[model samples]
Target: MLLEVRDLHVEFHTRDGVAQAVNGVSYGVEAGETLAVLGESGSGKSVTAQAVMGILDMPPGRITGGEVVFRGRDLLRLKEDERRRIRGAEMAMIFQDALSSLNPVLSVGDQLGEMFTVHRGMSRKDARAKAVELMDRVRIPAARERVRQYPHQFSGGMRQRIMIAMALALEPALIIADEPTTALDVTVQAQVMELLAELQREYRMGLILITHDLGVVADVADRIAVMYAGRIVESAPVHDIYKAPAHPYTRGLLDSIPRLDQKGRELYAIKGLPPNLMHIPPGCAFHPRCPLARDVCRTHEPPLYEVSGTRGSACHFWTECLNG
Candidate 1:
């Protein structure tokens, strides 16, 4: 495994109360494989990624427990400097919003070149050249000219491409892309995803793609991990998940997607909002909105039970869910 997150827990301390943003989340990704962490907003998807990247804002947020094992070493155990070294050269993150993430004051060339200058000790001239190469690699046209452009000068999709270029500049072994196609049109979204997939194949990089759009992951993800209220409710190969979901939450998400076969019909939406992380209900966190939820779901928390050699579900009546 290139990355193995074991029983990860993250908490946020606010004046109101502590929010258990991530509760015992566990998942793994391998080199050249894409693991899609699927869930609604505030389901601990992005928080877990931040923790893995060592970018979580401490004081307000902290990794309370669990291990984030990257390669053979435990990332959580690494010193700050050691982790910083690994962050860009070994593993990189492509944030959701490219506009805000990029520095408004800096040119895109400078931002991309900084990785080479800082990590590889390349001279400014060489770094600038490498930045242009990265921009071209990501299929940004007129890369030489656009290299010196600011983030505001580019279109939304173009800005995202620049972000991808920056993330790939160092040719890291792992890439965590959090909602990489969030605000783009459907056409542009496909293009970005296809670009990522192509780059992943070329570099043989392990990818952790965090997104709430099931449609986006359907074509790109090798495996899917469905999160609800900070816990993984179902995990399986992408085909298996869409064909037959083993948890109610996963089923709800699938049903919520707009299907062409069901034209002129009302779109399905999951009932009830996601539970408050600060006050997550006892037992299964998704029970309040689960149609299959029963009395057992209200009291005893279900462990992730093996549904198959490659699948698991944290639902007591997983068998019923699968066969339903």
Candidate 2:
């Protein structure tokens, strides 16, 4: 495993109350593998990624428990400076919003070159050359001419490619991309994902792709972990999840995907909004919206039940769900 997040728990102490963002979320990713964390907004997908990247803001946010083990070291135990050295060179994160993430004041070359300049200790001249190389590597046209452009000068997809280029600059063992295609059109989304898959194959890096869209990850992800209210509701191979989801929450997500065969028919949507983190319900957090929810679901929380050698579901009636 390139990265193992064991029983991770993270919470935010806000004016209202403590919002449990990640609750005992455990998942692992191997080199050359892609793990897709799927869920609605606020299901803790991004929070878990932030924790693993050592980028979660403190004061309001805190890691209450769990260990993020990477390359035989517990990242949670490392000092801030120690973690900093590992961030870009050892592991990198491609955030959702490229324009917001990038420095608007700096040229794209300066931004990309800073990785080499700061981490690899290359001189300004050398770093700039490497920056052009990265832009070319990501298949951005006219790399030499456009390296001087700011984030706003490029199209949305191109800006995203720059983010991908930055993440790949150091060739880290792992890359965590949080909703990389959220802002692009359908065609551009496909292009960005295809580029990411192609690059992942070339580098053989462990990828943790955080997104709510199941369709986007179907072709790329080896495994899927469905989260609900800060917990993993189901985990299985990508194909198995699409075939037959073992948790109601996972099933709801799969049904919610727009299908061409069901065109003109009303699209399926999971009932109710995701629960507030600060006041997650007792037992199963998704029970309020679950069709198969029972008294057991409302009173007793279900531990992750082993369904098969390679699968797990945190639903009490997983067998029935699988059969359904």
Candidate 3:
């Protein structure tokens, strides 16, 4: 396994009581595989990413339990210095907002070359050459000249490319990409995703694609985990998820996707908002909005159950949902 997150739980100490941000989350990504974590805003997707990256706000947030194992070693057990060394070299993250992530005053070349300088112990001259190569690899035109430019000089898409170059600079074994194509046009989004997929294949690295875009996951993810109200509701192979979703939440997400085949019909949407993290409802978190929800769904929390050889869903009516 390249990365393994087992029974991960993250809680925030707030005035309204402890907000369960990540509740019993568990997943893994194998070498050369892409696992997409799918959810809307406030579904704890970003919080989970922050936890994995060890960047969660410490005063309010804490990892209550569980282990993040990479290559059979538990990351939670590592010293702060040890984990710091592994962050960029062994595992990297491409955050949602490149503009905010990049240092405004630093030249792009210096930022990119820092990976080489810190990890590979390369001289500035040599590192800059490698940086240019990486920028070119991510399809930024005229990388040598562009390397001298500040982040503000590039367009949104180009800046995103620069972020990708920086993330891949050390060729980390695992990458967590959190909404990497956000704020870009559709055309640029396609290009960036294609580039990410191509680079991932070339490097044979495990990828965890965190996105709200179902279209992006459809294109590149090998497996999919659907989250709602801070917990995983469904998980399965990508094809199985689209073909037959076993949870109402998963089904609702699929229904919300605009379908060309359904011409002249209105777009479907999942009604109501995601539950508040501070006070999630008892039993099924999604029961309030689920059309198929029964009394059992409102009275008791359903444990995730194996519905097929390759899929599982946390639903009392998985068979009903599947058959319906």
Number of the candidate with higher lDDT, 1 or 2? 2
lDDT of 3 by residue, 52-100 (tens): 7777898699999989898888888888898889899889999888999
lDDT of 3 at 195: 96
User: Please, what are the lDDT tens digits per residue for candidate 2 over residues 176-291?
Assistant: 99999988999999899999999999999999999988788797899999999999989899999999999998888777777867565676788888999999999999999999
**lDDT measured at residue 72 in model 1 versus the true structure, 0 to 100:** 93
Q: Give the 10-residue window scoring lowest on summed lDDT in candidate 1.
A: 259-268
- Highest lDDT among the candidates is held by which one? 2
**Better model by TM-score: candidate 2 vs candidate 3:** 2
Task: Tell me the lDDT of candidate 1.
Answer: 0.93
Predicted candidate 1 versus true structure: per-residue lDDT over 10-48, tens digit per residue:
999999999999999999999999999998889999999
Q: What lDDT does the true structure give each of the candidates?
A: 0.93, 0.94, 0.91
